[model samples]
Target: MNTNTGDDKSFLNRLSSIVEANLSDEHFGVTELADKLRMNRSSVHRKLKSITNKSVSEFIREIRLQKAKGLLEEGSDNVSEVAYNVGFGSPSYFSKCFHDYFGYPPGEAKNHTKTESDPIELTEEGKTTKTFKQPSRMILVVIAITVLLGAYLVYQKLSGNPSEKSVIVLPFKNLSSEESTQYFADGITEDILTQLAKISDLQVVSRTSSEQFRETALSSPEIAGKMNVNFILEGSIRRQNDNVRISVQFIDARHDRHLWSENYDRQLADIFAIQSDIAKNVAKQLQTILSPEEIKQIEKLHPKNAEAYDKYLMGQYLCLKRDSISIRKGIEYFNQALEIDSTYTLAYSGLADGYYALSFTGYIDRKIGYARAYEMAEKALDMDSTLAEAYAVLGIVSKFGYWKWEEARKYFEKAIEVDPNCMVAHLYYCSFLDIVGEPDKAFEQVNRAIELEPYYHMTFRMKGIILCDEKRYEESNEALKRSYELNKESYYNYSRIFLNYLALNDEAAALEKLRELFALRPEYLEYKNDITPLYESSGINSVLKMFLDARLELGNEDDHFLIPILATKLGMQNEALTYLEKACAEKTRDIPRMIRKPELEVLYSNPRFVALVDTMNLSPYFQKLSE
Candidate 1:
């Protein structure tokens, strides 16, 4: 009755063959392998565990790591190249895994090639047996001692600087039969994530990254490995009438162990209390000490009206969809929430976000959209001064709408100070830094934001835009490609890609991207295909005249600074200076950015341009170039 003999051997043979065939595909994990084997995931898992004494994920990882080690020993490629070749999405993650598994980093693997051995090969009996070259007794003793010392040092280092506490709250499942309640479960998951992020003592993965695993077949360890998180929280929500039920479990993802589990059945009004309780319990279980202010922040509740809160959550759920139609619908839901509770600060903040989205996406008149955003943001802050989102909204409005640089900077700084994990604040501040002639500082802030929300399309798009401005075309295209992969329908990502191609002087690629941009939003067809044709046909002077004519006809106030850049690109030094003076008089936020723009180099030699730079107090930022 030993089932591990015949078919088991065949299964192991097939699995080994598949793994070897796809050894370089980093994404060839348990799910893909299961699909390839034509077996259900659970069945594949059980069979693999029984045969290999390891979970499916662990088996696949070991295969990849072993392949990577072999590649390194061969010395054909550098460590990073080997990492990517072995299907690792990130080289650093690959290096860490390699070091943990092989007792040495890949960088040092080449130097110690004499000690390396071939990886274990699978036999027909479905068992692993290593073959090693025989060595002298003294050599064996020396190797054993070296291994013991390395293990001791690793233990000491791990104990001293314990890894930072991190968690990913997976999207809560809707256990209710009614699919309409899915939004409620999603909102609850996001609220819990937001509460944890406010602690400043934990690295909470952003909703975008966690949402990717909503329907994934990957095991807990696999998800945790990909996200680089130690803990995972998953839950389900069941709602019946006025009573709601939530069951949550906190898991130590690294060890695949459940650390805590709780269930709550409460009236709808007590949902806020339930959320707060869950967050506090998680923090306590993780042994994270929260400051008094952090505790108070977490304990703070929104409006008392359950209906209003539900409406607000619905609004937030729609807002996160990030489309023009969804944004408008979100606005309606926010307004509904406000109608139910006129004094709801979060509702006001949501409304402000909706308006800001409208303005930023060009779905509405910028002036009207931004003015409403400003008003709503002010109201939110007046009601709750500690609201980080409200401050972020105000900062964005000030930066893009009013061009109030100092005020925008202050608001952005205050938002981060209030909530250190606020990704929006970090993103806006990064863009602000870029516009203010501090590309190095801007790069740092964008990277921090990316660390917080790695899968967020807008964050990557902004990174691409910033890199494009810095004239790092190759890096900019890589980021933009990632952003496009996250959400291919986004015109924002496509536009940046277009700009990057243009900067790199790849006219065909730029045109292709421009067409994609136009395809996504046909309203831009005229601007992309028709009005801007003069620049390609004649020169910047012809394009400048056409721009002037269009401005006179359209009367758009934004992007006025582009006129000077066009003039400068045409080699019209006086015209560029004149346009720059006009832009300065208008308090254009883009003025500072011109310092690094190659198009504006002609104007830089002018004393007026230098004076304008000095007047903006941008000399200090430029001075950093030398330092």
Candidate 2:
């Protein structure tokens, strides 16, 4: 009995050491702990249960909760930061677990003393031998049962039938001695992600989220737990003059075991073929059968000249920065790529994206910028009709440039059909639905985009907008606040906050947000000054009138569509009808989007407004709300 007590204490001490070493790993559960201890999973479960009278999962959770409690008491970080540091992806989940374990929430831990005793005890009475007689015979029986069960499970897993597979391709490490080759490594990682995204049978985490783990010290299982994926693909790239070397490994994140690994040494021109082979091997390992169409898409090589491809990759990297200077530089690099190889379809697509971004951000003349975007997007489609990004660009042009609502919808839908994982397509379609008076659909699509790219601020902003349209003011504010937290300098997000506060009838909050917006972009000072006095003196209607008058004086065709909504808000029915008729004649895209505006509620009952809606073919989307 004394020997058994010593063995139990030794086992628990070893287990405690392992758990403490990986306290920050969220996925250090049964399988990972088993792998670390060099024991079968069932054995780990049985041993942990015998020692602590708790399941393996419960043991892991208790360790995490205890660590989090200590951190909270230290007061080094807030609840959210402490939660993530202790390997909880969500602070809310951590709070629930902490409360369940300690009978108090984590927020109270900092103010409270540590009085709760440890659950595990090393007393002689706690030994397993005390609870069961004939310990040796029982151990042999349990081992025999565990062996049979383990063999059966291993046989089933090895028979090639596995559960749903999802993977994250971590940012590839740049093994090259030159720091300048980092872009090359990033480009390769993004290319591999894009190739895998084309497979509808596979779930590939976006580069935005995976890139966060580039320098992370967390183990593969920990990362997989945070990303909620089954497999992890990580590699290193080394480029020298004209030769490139890549080393890649695939790991089953659940088991914390490597499934496959390879090394490739090839010329720079064979990079596309290398990416294709790696993707195919990963798919095979995951037991995903690729269709012929998906195979073609994965193998498609655009730029024949390696230098032009390099330039295009640089251009794409710059364009993703989404700043005016970076956009101009991206355009220059894309033009250089086109000059090197005129038939480069991706270069044209990049050019279109750059110009469209410039136009959307109001940094350039919309008419000229969107016209150039339309031309380049059409050229890209002419070169390769199957390109999902080209289709998305065409959809943007149709919606913002030509105001062809039906055409825009078709193009957006076609982009999704071509590539279901296209983030741009999903976001654009969400915007389209918002404009067409389908707030519910817009909310659904935006949520989908958020799931695919959880760290992206733009999707959160769009979600806020959809919620605002639905009049869910509190939720809208929450989403917008999240967006603001992600990007504090975003003028667009600030403006949305201002509008949301105004709609919620919080004038002081609205004015505060307005000041923040003006502080960020002083170019809007004129409009801000003009609207503030009218709002303070005569309320929102007078402010609407002032905005309508200013827009009329601006003499921009795109500014005219908003006049009808403002006029209707001020009870000027005749003026509203005239402006609405003019907007219909001009085929303004905002007219369709204004269908769900609360200010336009009065116009919905007017005969001339009904006529204008019919003329614009917007009757199908006209809201039929009950009073």
* Model 2 vs. true fold: TM: 0.59
List of clashing residue pairs for candidate 2: none
lDDT of 2 by residue, 1-627 (tens): 344477888888888788878877655555567789999866777776666666666666677788888888888899999888876766776776676466456887864565332121112221111110100100001111111222222232443424445778888898877655665667767777776666655567899889779899999989989988878878887767767677777788978998766567777556556545544444443333456676566546435666777777777876876665456556766777788889998899998898888766555656667778878888998988888888998898787666677899999999988777788899999988887777777887899889878978889988887887788877988998898787765555775676677678887787777666644432233456555677778887776565565445333343344566567757887987787676556545455555566657677878887887666556666654422
Badly placed stretches (over 4 Å) of model 1 are: 1-164, 266-290, 492-502, 505-597, 600-627
What is the lDDT, from 0 to 100, of the residue 224 in candidate 2? 88
**Model 2 ranges with Cα > 4 A deviation:** 1-163, 175-178, 215-217, 240-243, 265-289, 506-627
lDDT of each: 0.68, 0.68
Model 2: ten consecutive residues of lowest lDDT: 131-140
lDDT over C-alpha atoms for residue 181 of model 2: 63
lDDT value, candidate 2, whole model: 0.68
Q: After superposition, how far is residue 525 of candidate 1 from its true place, in Å?
A: 11
Summing lDDT over every window of 10 consecutive residues in candidate 1, give the lowest-scoring window: 135-144
